[model samples]
Every structure is written in C-alpha cells, then in structure tokens.
Target: SRSKNSNKERNLIRAFTVLDAYASKLSMPENAKEHAAYIYRKAVSKDIIRGSSIPSMMAASVFAACKQLGIPRSMNDTAKVANMSKKKLSRTYKRLVKNLELNVSSFEADYVSKISNSLSVSEKTARLAGKIIHDLKKEHLHVGKNPIGITAASLYLSAINYDEHVSIEKISKKTNISTVTIRKMIKLLRPFASKYLKSIDLSV
Candidate 1:
C-alpha cells in the first residue's frame, strides 16, 4: 500500500515537471496551470494515462487547459514548447478530450482581440477583425478552419481595410501559421469580408 501511494506521488511529480516546462514557455496564467495539473490527476484516476507516455499526457493536459481557458496558443506553439511533433500532440490532445469529455469553450469573436494584442496590431484593426470573425461565424464559415489561421486571416484583412500596411507574412509570423495557409484562408474569407470592409475607404 505504501509503495502504491509512493508511485502516485512520483507520477505526479513527473507530470507537473513536464507541465511546468511548457507552461513557463507559454507564460500561462496560474489558474490555467493549476487546472491542467488537476486535469492530469483526473486522467490518472481514470487510468487514461496507461498507454500514453507521461510527457505526452502532460502536453495534452496543458493544451486542453489552454482551450478550456480560451488562451490563444496554437497547436504548433504547443508542439514547439512541449518538444513533441504536432501530429503526436494533436493525437494526444484528441484522446484526452474524448476520454475526459471536456467541454472547452468555443472561440469567440473577442478572441481576435487577444490575437491582435499579441501581434501588437492596432485597436481599430482588432475591432474590425472581431467584426469579421463575428460575421463569418454568423454563417458558420469558420467551422472547419484552424482558429489561429482564421484569426490571422481576419486580422490581415482588417489591417488592409484600415490601411494599416501589414503583410500576410507578418501576420503569419505573429500567429505561427505558414504564409500559404493564411493566404488560402484569406482567399475564401475575403469575399465574405469584402462587404464589411466596404464601409471603410482605407485608400484615403
């Protein structure tokens, strides 16, 4: 019985150590960090951690916490910080979500504000992006798209509409998306956003 208890402690330490490493890199809020640790414990109690490696489980926990907390960290960003491949991290994340049946908050239009702030975009552009995302969501245009890419696309279009002189490459860098993906996202979304941008004559 003592050894069993000791094993649980060691597992917790290993899990927290891995979580702390990635959380520090992301500068995650204390609440989100604690929630992740708590979720890790739940996973252990459910025996969902059996087949998966500890680091992968830790990565998934923190990633889920970010989603639950509505943090704007991308899967690529999570992959980078966790020192794991994106595919692997995503697979683990999906498993955790499935087993835990976690009810993550959906990304809101206001999430654009967080993304814009991280990229240092102007407030005006951020508002425009929010409007764009809100409008797009009205018709379910963003349903299957990657959140970071879609947000980046909206911000890029908003900047152009506001005559802010920002480039897709720049937005790509800020959001950690490839320029190609942002371009594709913009291509589809631009038509829908055109009517919105019409009100502002940025050319002036």
Candidate 2:
C-alpha cells in the first residue's frame, strides 16, 4: 500500500523550502545557520508561519534572530530591508505571538511603533496606544475573545482618540480590518473616546 501524505507533511516540506530561501537571501553567517534552524524549527512547531506568508514570517524571524545575535537592526530599517508593509507585518507578528502563545510584550511595542512610524506619528503616540490596549486587556475587554479583532478595534480607537489625523478609511486600509467594524468600534468607544483623548499628549 502507498503511504498517504498529510497536510502536516506538505506544510513541513514547504516550511523547509521557505527556510532555505530565507537563509540564502540573508547570506547569514556560518554559525548563524544553527540559530536560523532553531528559530525555523520553533516557528514550524508553533504552526503560525504558513508558506504563503513565509516572507512575513521570515521578516519577523530575522528580527528575532538579530535580537538574539545582538545584531541591532531598527524596526523601520528591518521593514524596509524586508520590503514588507509595516502594518501588515505588524498584524502578522501579532498572529505569530498568538500562535506561539508567547508571553513576551516587547514585540507588541514593536508592532505599535511600526504602525506609528508608518503613519508618521511620534513614538509617544504609539506608546500611548499600547498603554490604552494594555489597560483594556486588564479590564477584561479581551476576556474569552478573539484577540486580533479586539486589538484591531483597540488600535483604531486609540488612533482616533489620540487625534492622529489618520482617517478611519486609512486605518481600515492599513490594518486590513473592515471599515464597518472600524466605524462600529469607533461608535462603541465614542463616550469614552473624549475622556481618553484628554489624557494623552498629541504633539507630533
């Protein structure tokens, strides 16, 4: 009898192919191959880095690799070098965290900063949005829920509350969330939006 190939087997083969391409592109140091393999293995084990989005995963993985190796590339620089959209990559990074169940919050900061940097806002604005999202999480807004939906909602609300001048359409376009959902989230936050706005510094 012939053996059957499962989805997992196909995914594994694709994963290896992606890793090979990534390693070739980076021309990573000889010793770095081991580190790359380690990270790739972890990503595969986690099952979040799909072959279709391997480039995005590779971008995040390279950032992770750089941090581990103390290579020090700025988020903006990495996004540029990777030629990936910062906002889309940020969303992918969040998906990676959810899939890996990682407790690390620093990557969240990078996500927010990437959005701010992309929107040409100050880092402070991003930090403020991060704070709002953190506070919301503590209040159980994210309880028993879809985190990506909650996060996209929270970020949209935060951008408006901070008076960032980025229209809802633009946020929808950037975050890839539906405009209807954005409007709904905005309306839901309306009563509290003004209150939140009063507390954050809007310079920049």
Candidate 3:
C-alpha cells in the first residue's frame, strides 16, 4: 500500500512551486527578489500549512516581504488571506525581520507598492502612506521604535482621515500592536493630518 501525504505537506509543495515561479518573474530591487525567495522557503518549511492554499502562502510570503523590507501590510488583512493564526504568523514574521536585518530608516517606494498590492489596496493609498512616512521622518519623530508598528500606524491614520473607514482593531490585528498604540499614533498626527490630507488631495 502507498503512504498518503498530509494536506499541509501538499500545500507546502504547491507553495514552493508557486513561489519558484514568482521568483522567476519578479523584476525589482535585488533585495526584493531575495526577500521574496526567503518568504517562499519559509512557507514551504512550515508544518501546518497545505499545498492547496497557495494564496495563503502567498499572503504570508508577502507579509514577510513587507516586514523584511520595512513596508507595512495590515496583519489582520494579510492573515485573513493567508488563513493563519495571528500569533503564529507574528512569530514567523519577526524571525524573518531579524534575519533580514532590514533598514527602517530608508523608505523603499517599490517595496511599499508591493505591500499595497499584497493587501489589495490602491496605489494611491500606498503612495499616501509612503508620503506620510517620508514626512514623518522630516519631523525627526521617534517612529522607528518599531518599523512595522509605525508603518501600520501611518497607514491607519491616512485611512481614517481620508474617510477610508478602517478600524483601529483591524489595523491592530495586522501590526500586532495594541489599540492604545494605534490611538496614540493617531493623536500625535492630529496636527499634521490636515496638512497631509490637503496635500494628498491636491496631488490627486
């Protein structure tokens, strides 16, 4: 009799195939490709995930990519697509972030765009978040305590001010930050939000 493989094993194998394909087609910064490949490998090695769930793998890989490159994608949204537990994904995500030794000081516009695509948000929204991030840097704000944390905060601020209606709970779930931190970041940005919103509006 032949032995049967588990669904998780099958998923890992399928994820590896898809990631290998993505690696072949990807055209971007050298680091992006490397990070993408790293994420693919990580997902393939996970014991609980399945081969039929390539999209979930893709989501996890993309989330890893975002962290590795210092771009932010909401954890709740990403996990929803990936079908993984927040705690499990967060641990994996942090490990990747540490291994990659990513730079949070320098903003990567391309990586931000990729994250936006992964989250299925508009380029404009991504660009807005990127711009706000850039502006925040100018203020010499100590937002770098946690790159992903700040990035999520910035995006959430942008979303709320623009009437995008993304809840703090949702953003908190994705970034693994508390709702209090999210609220604090929003409060800190209140003075600048109006100006940033106006600028974004004019640019559009």
User: Number of the top candidate by lDDT?
Assistant: 1
Q: All candidates' TM-scores?
A: 0.59, 0.41, 0.43
Model 1: colliding residue pairs: none
Every candidate's lDDT:
0.81, 0.57, 0.57
Model 3 ranges with Cα > 4 A deviation? 1-119, 198-204
Clashes of each: 0, 0, 5
Model 1 CA lDDT for position 172: 71
Off by over 4 Å in 2: 1-110, 144-149, 188-192, 198-204
Candidate 1 C-alpha lDDT tens digits along 47-159:
89989999888888998997876655678888888888999999998988999999875565545766788778899888888787877888998886787778888888888
lDDT of 2 by residue, 1-204 (tens): 223336656655675576566556565554454655566557766666665366677667665665444333445655665678888667765676567654444344555665556566655666666766676666666454333334445566576555766766666555545677656655543444445676653332
Global Cα lDDT for candidate 3: 0.57
Measured by TM-score, how close is model 1 to the native structure?
0.59
Error of 2 at 121 (Å): 2.4
Q: Can you tell me which runs of candidate 1 are displaced by over 4 Å?
A: 109-131, 134-204
Estimate the Cα RMSD of every predicted model relative to the unseen true structure.
6.5, 13.1, 11.9
Residue 26 error for model 2, in Å?
A: 29
